[model samples]
Target chain A: MNVPAATRAIVVARIRKLWPVLLVSVAAALFFGWLYQNAIAGRQAGGEVNLGAPDAWLLLPTLFTTAIAVAVAFACTSHANRDPFALVEDAAPLFGRERARANAIIPVTIALAAAAAQYAGARLSPHYATPPTFFLFNAIAAIAAMLVALSIPLRDGAARILYALLACGSTLICTVVALAVIGFTNGVAAAKAGLAYYPNFNDLWGGVAEASFAALIGFIALRQYGEALARYDPLPPANE
Target chain B: MAILEMRRASFARGRTNIVAPISLQLEEGGTLHWRCELAQAGRVLARMAAGIVKCTAGSVFIGDYDPKIQPVQVKRLVGFIPHPPPSNPFDSPQAYFAYRSDLWNLQCASAVERGMRIFLALHAQPPNLALAVSGALLHEPKLLVAENLEAELFDELANLRGAAALFATR
Candidate 1:
């Protein structure tokens, strides 16, 4: 069979198996959105509602997108790494660099889609214009999460642990940098400056930090993946 | 010409040496039954022969192609049926064989014919195991490396000994 045909078969099979999980994730996102709207509605009924900061609009959506992206990545990596059929699949003539690329498509697609939806949702919210930089940052972060998740199945023990730490550490550093730049540099006065103006300095800095971290993690994962492909021995040695 | 050759090949997992330096060669239409009590060792050997695992030291070649350096070419020349049958509950035997045929770029008609022949030859064995054997044979590989061959399948595999180099580990 042709590469395209085989890839289609594999992808179709995977989607058939994964559709339920994907549906559940979508439902979860919708549920979270509903809860957020409900909370806002309740607050508004009581009287004065402060919608100055875009933080509230950004927080839940970002969390949901990241959570979903991470989940998809983990699922895909774990399936590829731990499947009993891994040896059989790896031994096939078609199993090579192309297969790895093909395997990444689903997770990457889902992640980017979720990020886009989150961005659109945030933009439509009453409190924020949702800066382009912020949107780009969130998209990168989601992609990074997917990459990290993809790497999990490729390595084990210390290597896996190290990658996990790198992902978490980088994201944490980005958050801190974003907070320091936005919270410390601009202070409360800038935050209260409203959403009509250019994004708060902190949001832009946060975007920069997140994008840099994402790029770092993405670069490392891709390099590792390439090396793994070069080494490309799926089965373990006798003792191991 | 030798279909499979290993030159003082050694394999390590982490700090432990699994396959100590060993040299062996199997020519076309030759058979090697590497019997060992250590099932893991058998598995490692099968994987090495199939180009699924690189030898930590020395070299391994399948039909003159280095498994480590030219894995795709080497894999095309070898068929590996690993122990425990790499089960995928979601796939039926037919579907699995079809997928394998596609991966190996085999002609669908010939693959199906060969698969059926193998299945019939192992009629008494479990259906899944029979299917697995047929799947391995779909490519009509020049070398067959099977791990943990059962007593029943021995005769069937031995029949291929005259045509394709056979390597079995148990």
Candidate 2:
């Protein structure tokens, strides 16, 4: 049905209104990445290069949390603003499932791009080497968490607040679980040693599990969003 | 068979009924002007017939397709001009037509050019009723639903061969 073409059209329309927010999302991610690099560099110059001393271990979690928060914020802003689809909605030969998928494009891209940018920036630190295998999977998990948070019905003020909290909490939980998996597989000794070498198979398996978890959550959340989009009635709000 | 039909369809919010149960039909080359108050209730009714608002009871159909179950097919068959038409986002009429062509994923450049010429010819006043109708007709839909349209324009619109029209009047 030329789903890509339909999705592209919708995204283009949305981008006209939302380019500023998207720019901010990317800038914020880059800034955080630069900040992480500085933090690690500062710790290394002072001779406290260990992960625990500089709280270097907190880097991944913090990065993911901030990226997801930005994504959630973007979602809220888009929702509160004028409906982008209102114009062509009734005339276009696109239904609810396609609409839902089209809607997710901007936010999901924001989350993934932000995560990638920040991780790249942090890699510039002299103390750090290649990124861990699990980090990518955890980043995916963050995307899933963001989707779950966005799936919360934005009918009212209470729902908005709940969505924000859920976004933060879900991403944070996913990041922590991913870290815990790595910690358990390699123990505290590996963490105490600076992150220099590539991650082992144990770490890789843990990452797969974490990424799989994210995929499952994202799938379910997307389906729910599609169903809700189908049932959604915009008349009441417009009439009021 | 009717190109558009509503069988005792109704819409409500909470306990209040926005549109009372109503039945109507329009066939090819025919026209129906529904008279109601313009602001709230009539707008809702027009949207219901266009499949933008689902009926709380009964059903609505466009060329044998139920809007609730086959929204894409119904939308493909129907051309809609809403009460408060959306403003033109593009700088030129050609750009607007291009945007529509891209959106609907149709290679109807010729049709778009024809629609644009019609739009420019008729768009002399404000609120852009001409632009709305011309844009709606770009898809060459079998049924057209226009809300709160000017009565004088109906004769002009009827010139389009074989397309049924439903106009909501104040």
Candidate number of the best DockQ: 1
In model 2, what is the error at residue A172, expressed in angstroms? 2.8
After TM-score superposition, the amount by which residue A192's alpha carbon in candidate 1 deviates from its true location, in angstroms, is 13
lDDT of 1 at A9: 52
The global C-alpha lDDT for each of the candidates, from Candidate 1 onward, is 0.66, 0.65
Per-residue CA lDDT of model 2 for A190-237, tens digit only, reads: 354333222432366457656766677678877877787677665624
Q: What digit string (tens of lDDT, one per residue) describes model 2 on residues B1-170?
A: 78878899988888988778889888766788787753567777777777666889989888899888887788787777766666775566676666666667777578678777768666554535666777777777777877666676656666652455654543
By summed lDDT, the worst window of 10 consecutive residues in model 1 chain B runs over: B86-95
Error of 1 at B55 (Å): 1.1
RMSD of each: 5.4, 4.6
Screening candidate 2 with a backbone cut-off below 3 angstroms (N, C-alpha, C), the clashing residue pairs are: none
